[model samples]
Target: MMAKKYSNKINKIRSFALALIFVGFIIMYAGIFFRGNPIVMLIFIILGMLSLVFSMVVYFWIGLLSTRAVVVNCPNCDKPTKILGRVDMCMHCREPLTLDPELEGKEFDEDYNKKSRQTKQT
Candidate 1:
């Protein structure tokens, strides 16, 4: 079996926000089918606009979080990337990264980032 691939948290959140934008537009376009029924069309359009507004909020939130994230060059790819948690995949190469020295050179596991897990280890 192939190992599961992990994505950087920042990239993942951004991707989700971008997808929401597309979904919102698609929903609005679908409203065109109900043009004869003004009420239904208006409802669909309103829902789509809500989705778009929510996406904008998400983007803004992530943007602020990104400014606070740790930036480091990936050892594998030699490119700058942001790390959101203790363990995160590289943005350019998906290589596992860690801020804690104790966890270095070990198998990549998301559980390592959990506070409960670290406290147990200690």
Candidate 2:
């Protein structure tokens, strides 16, 4: 079986926020089709606005997480990358990296970041 592709956590969250924006805009556009029904149009508009506002909140959260992420130089690509959890991938090369020596050379698993596993790593 082929190994699963992993992406930098920050990039994943960032992309999700972007997707939310697109979805919100699409929802608002759909509201135009219901212009004859003011109540239905209003509902769609409000829901779309909520989606947009939530996306902004997610963006702000990622910004805060960025400040706390650990920065390290990727051994494979020799480029700097940020690690948000116990296990993460290099943003440039997608090399699996771990902060725990015990996990080094092991198969890359995102579950290593879970609170239950964090205690084991420590």
Query: Residue 120 in candidate 2 has what lDDT?
Result: 75
The superposed Cα distance between candidate 1 and the true structure at residue 18, in angstroms, equals: 0.6
lDDT of 1 by residue, 1-122 (tens): 99776889888899999999999999999999999999999999998999899999999999999999999999999999999878999998999999989989899999988999989999
Give residue 69's lDDT in candidate 1 (0 to 100).
93
Each prediction's Cα lDDT score? Answer: 0.92, 0.93
Instruction: Name the regions of candidate 2 deviating beyond 4 angstroms.
Output: 119-122
Model 2 TM-score on a 0 to 1 scale? 0.92
Model 2 lDDT tens row, 1-122: 99677899999999999999999999999999999999999999999998999999999999999999999999999999999988999999899998888888899999998998877767
Q: Which stretches of candidate 1 lie over 4 Å from their true place?
A: none
The worst-scoring run of ten residues by lDDT in candidate 2 lies at 113-122
